[model samples]
Target: MALDPQAKALLDMVYRVGAPRFHELDVAQARHSFEKLQFALRPEMPAVASVTDVPIPQARAADGVIMARLYRPLSAGPDEILPLTFYFHGGGWCIGNITSHDVLCRELANHSKAAVLSVDYRLAPEHPFPAAVDDALRAVQWSLANAGMLGIDPTRFALAGDSAGGTLSAVTALAQRNAQGPRAALQLLIYPSTDILSQRPSRREFANGYMLDTGSLTWFFEKYLPEEDDWQDWRASPIRAARFDGLPPALIITAGCDPLSDDCKAYGEVLREAGVPVEMLEFEGMVHGFITLGKFFSQANEAVLQAGEALGRAFAAGGAS
Candidate 1:
């Protein structure tokens, strides 16, 4: 499909105004550049609860002191036990937080008719790769061990995130499978970074113009990894792992114009080949971070709805588990 008018408008604005020459800029300047790009997409969005009618509160992961923003869909108030989604916001695992991704989580919670726990994990460069992964694992562990306290059903929860956060979600699943961590019902990955290699054709082809460019990605990788070898570690680059068997069911979302699009495709293939029930959907002509742009971009809205529906089917219907 051709680029929708709204998505095209977004690309035009990004190239025309938001694209910063961060090559020589300081770290703070580059961070500002990234934030400006996001703001340019939509200067502001309604509060998460307004968008999805969810009650939002802050929770803490006991071990790492990781903060988690819990979203209970208005459709399911206190006293109503609902399926849960533990989400990590996407920002190459180095940036973004609960507020940056609040709207997305609420939509997922409301649209999927399930509670959403949007975790605010520690960022990279300051905290780095394994830190985020560790926080994610511990958050899941705490959620399971204390599900009753949080009013969640331990057996009815799932893991989800976009981009690098998606990497954490995927790795968290593998961790559970490998170390026998708390079992999640399913995993939802939105254009996830299953591979840290980032050398696929999509990365090269969309390197310069896409929302998440090669240069920016390089910055993120540099900031997130503790060492070069971490790039190949399964915890960082899950697609590099030898096996993905025995993991939970997965729904992988990919964007045709995203630098990491092929990562999602490859990961979906890996999951399927490993006998994990997997569903893959690629949004053609769409750029990276479509989930965040849905308010102004029609394809993005459609994609989120499709994703929410998929989550609903996977969790509520209780299939493919």
Candidate 2:
């Protein structure tokens, strides 16, 4: 499909209004910029189920401090727990926070009508590698364990994220599968960083000039991974996993113009070959993080709604539905 005029205008505006996102900024500054963009969007989103930040007192990771903002619809009131999504924000695992993804979460919660739990996991290089995987796993387990208190229907829950956040989402599902932890009904991965190793042609083809340039990716990866060796670990690279079988059903969203596009496509294809039910979409002319640019890009909002529609179809009637 041709580039939507709105998409082009917003893309140009995003490039001009601010600087390309970088990993050099501290969490506070990065989050500030992210939140600024979110507020700028003030998008016309559907009236959601509901939204609130519920502290999980029992969810302290191996280190400490594990809290997630829980989102749901009004129908799924405090008394009714609904299928949940343990959502992680993206920023190469160093920048984004719940506040930054607040609108996206709202859109998802309103559209998916599930208990969307946006996690605030520990970032790096302060806490690297397994720390992120551990935090994500802990968040999922904590949500399931406290499903009652969190008003989430344990039987109907999913896991989702975008970009680096998408990487963590994939890892969380794998950890649950291998350890026989609570099952996630579905996995929603949006332009996820499936593999840290830049081995694909798209990596170079779409690398430099795109919104998420190869240069920025390298900088982000360096800050997140203490050593290059960490990329080999399956925790850092889901594509390196020995098997993707028996994992939850998946919804993989990719950008036709993204450097990591092939990696995301490869994951969906591999998962399907492994006997998992999967759905994939690559929006042409879109770049990395198109899922979160609703403020500036119409395609961003459209992608979210499209993903939400799929989630509704995948999760309608409940987890088994």
Candidate 3:
């Protein structure tokens, strides 16, 4: 499929002469660039019942505490306990913070009628590999353990994220399954980097022209994984996990033109083969990162609606079970 005109226009603007790509800039500059794009393209923030910043105390003292923002839908009653979706924002695990995804979390809460907890996991380079993964797992566990206090239904918890955040979600879900911890009702992965070691066709096919280019990916990986052998770790690459049979059902969203598309599809196939239910949605003619750019792409809004519906159905089933 041809590139969506809006995506093409974004690419044209991003790649205009003298514009510095992410790989060309320092980490701070790259993050600023990424945030600028998100801020300019994200839709206006919708009203929600409440938004609270919660600090999650890490199990390991040295890891300190991570922050998460919880959003309660406008329709939620003061005393009602809602299903919870622990959301991790994307930025290759290096750039984005809770504020970057505030609006998206609000939309998810309203549309899914679930409380959305947007986690601010420690970023890369300084924190490095396993840091974000550890933070993600800890946040979920903490949230589940204290669900009553947060006004969330512990039995109906879900995990959700996009891109690197999606990777964290997948890894965290796998870890929870392995540990026999509280199982998530669903896993919402949008353009997730399932395999860092992937050499799939889509990696090369959409490598350069897409918004998330090969250079930027390499940059992210390098910053996050300073150890070469960590690339094979299941936490870093969920597709490398030993098994997937007992994992939660997944809604895997992919962009047709994304370099990570094939890897995402492969992960879905792996889940299906293991007898785990999987729903895969591919946004054709779209590039990576379009889901958060609802201001520029109509499909972004459509995708969010689909994701919210999936979360609602999964939470409903969980509650019944």
TM-score of each: 0.89, 0.90, 0.98
Stretches > 4 Å off in candidate 2? 1-7, 14-29, 42-49, 57-62, 317-321
Q: Give the winner by TM-score: 1 or 3.
A: 3
Estimate the lDDT of model 3: 0.92
Best by TM-score: 3
Worst 10 residues of 1 by lDDT: 49-58
Ranking of all predicted structures according to lDDT, beginning with the best and ending with the worst: 3, 2, 1
In the range 1-321, model 1's lDDT, one tens digit per residue, is 355566677778767965564444556676666565556553244333322222222254344366777787767765776678889888877667777776677778777887788887778677876888888887787777777767777778888998887888999998888886556778889988877786788878888766677778877888888699888899988998878888888888888788888888988988899899898888788888877765577776677778777777767766323
Error of 3 at 273 (Å): 0.1
lDDT of each residue in 29-100, candidate 2, tens digit only? 766776676567646554566667766543434544676888786456657657777899998888778887
Q: What's the candidate order when arranged by decreasing TM-score?
A: 3, 2, 1
State, as a TM-score between 0 and 1, how close model 1 is to the true structure: 0.89
User: What is the C-alpha lDDT profile of model 3 across 1-321, one tens digit per residue?
Assistant: 579888899888877855787788998998898888889999999999999999888887886789999999999999999999999999998898998888888999999999999999999888899999989998998998898889998889899999999999999999898888888889999999999989999999998988888998999999999999999999999999999988899999999999999999999999999999999999999999999999999999999999998999999886512
Task: Give stretches of model 3 more than 4 Å off.
Answer: none
How big is the positional error of residue 30 in model 3, measured in Å on the Cα after superposition?
Answer: 1.1
